[model samples]
Target: MNFNFLDKLSPEYRNYKIERIKNGASKKLFFKISKGSDSFVCTDFNSDKLEYKNHLVVHRILSNIDISIPTLIEKNDDKLIIVSEDFGNLRYDKILKQQSIKDLLQYATDTLCIINKEINFNPTYTLPQYNIELFKNEIAELPQYYFSYNNIIDRIDSLNDEFFDIWIESFKQLNFNFKHFVHKDFNMNNLIFLPSREGHLKCGVIDYQNSFWGESSWDLFSLLEDSRIFFTDQYNAYFMNYFYSHSNQLISLKEFKLKYHLLNCSRQTRLLGRWVKLANELNQPWYLDFISTTKLRLQSSLAILQNNKLTKFYDKYIL
Candidate 1:
């Protein structure tokens, strides 16, 4: 598809030899420029005020912590261009598919440890407003979009009221002491793997606009329980132990287990609503593919909640 914004570039930017790389959501287009000595990336925004500002905030905040995010080169009212060290064509998703579990887990653990240490939590960021209430409201509204899929929609609809009530109650019951800047979408696709000087792998994070101050467990779950890639249970156990052993502030295994399940459910609930909305209202059918995976994760989390003494109340009310 021809991106309409490319033709509207300022005369100075139009001189560059532009190569369209790929198309992304929200009418964003990524391009590679050949005019400059160093290659740069140009992202065309679709006049979405919130989204544009969110991207700018991510760039500024992550860069301030010395994270290797792409540096902002320039921004017009509708476009934000950035330049930085490129990782060639190596993506973390590709690495996981081709590499061994041990190697991938090690890389992920080291990278997350670095990020956990460097991130500065900002109380003013609006992203963290995505709490349990927001999640419940989103799920409660999803049935409107999925109503056409009678059987699935009906099943989802049947649980909506109960789900939201229990979810909100559970959020209030749980301790929210855990606080850190979480990359809300911290999955392999948003990570770039580059070779380090010591001949090992290093990671660079990307697409951090949804970042917020929330439970660190959510980020850990996103890494270990990624929908695109599955980690072996044995490997997950080993990695979780590795993190607990190495961290200066130790997190108990039991606590980690509980938080992991809760965060997993929270994430899947949000994802389910998003997919339903995208497919039904936005006319994007591809998101439907995620339904099965989201259901699986939700069921697993519900099972864990049922087993926990603290969350067993969910069994009487929610399940």
Candidate 2:
């Protein structure tokens, strides 16, 4: 529980105060370590939990690309803790309520532009490909958890078959480009607002160990169509246009829109099921509060995609 490694950095750290950060929906333990007015984050994980290694590798990758991320202070693998600079409590999720959407999304879109252009197909650290198999696996959570929770487990096998058939068919038709970098959870909660930083750097990203090579629109939808927050259709349209016009990607807006909606549906479906898993298995009922919001988002995405088969499936069973 103590950051013994910090003692070597400075004698004052020996008396630091530590408190748990109970925010993320992960197995990792994050603690805020304070020494007088200064503070750092201590990430504690078991040896089997090697996400810290991914964090370290991604920290290097993002840092090299000039993305704003917390500075790594120390790594004590023996003690299973990684210490890094603390960005305080200014997470973008909390800020969304107070700031204008235009102002807030500008910084977020700017950061996304950088990520789209800068990140390579194969970085120094190897990443798992976001292929069809992985996509199906993720959406399977809907039937496995959500259906089971709602007592719709009777025809789960046939339901899953229909569900995946619609998705796989739509996915193949999309022919999505999967070469770009996807900060898999690139949403408001993972961003820290740094007022002092300039331009896109003002958007500080964290908890990106789950980063992978995937469609750029996946992260776009992650930011715009966040499961935790609801943005009106008009606002979503304006920003999607803003990101497309500014980034200057070669894809047409129509194609981009389809990709965005498709991915958002996939994401929201996973989260819909995940809420049940979190409530029943993780003992986190608060996640269930977002179920309505997540369901609405999924429905919206499904509507946008205009897949009758998928829409009918949701109407009949999952929705």
Q: Which candidate is the best by TM-score?
A: 2
Candidate 2 collision pairs: none
lDDT of 2 by residue, 124-175 (tens): 4677778999999999999888887777977778887888889899889887
After superposing candidate 1 on the true structure, give the runs of residues whose Cα lies further than 4 Å from its correct spot.
Answer: 1-15, 24-27, 35-38, 77-85, 124-130, 141-158, 196-201, 229-233, 245-251, 307-319
Quick one: RMSD of model 1? 4.2
Model 2 stretches with alpha carbons more than 4 Å out = 2-12, 47-49, 231-233
Q: What's the lDDT of the predicted structure labeled candidate 1?
A: 0.62
Give the lDDT of residue 135 in candidate 2.
94
lDDT of 1 by residue, 253-308 (tens): 77776777776876765666667676766677887777776666666667766745
Name the candidate that leads on lDDT.
2
Global lDDT of each candidate: 0.62, 0.81
| Total residue pair clashes for candidate 1 | 0
Model 1: clashing residue pairs?
none
Question: For candidate 2, what's the RMSD?
Answer: 2.2
TM-scores for all candidates?
0.78, 0.92
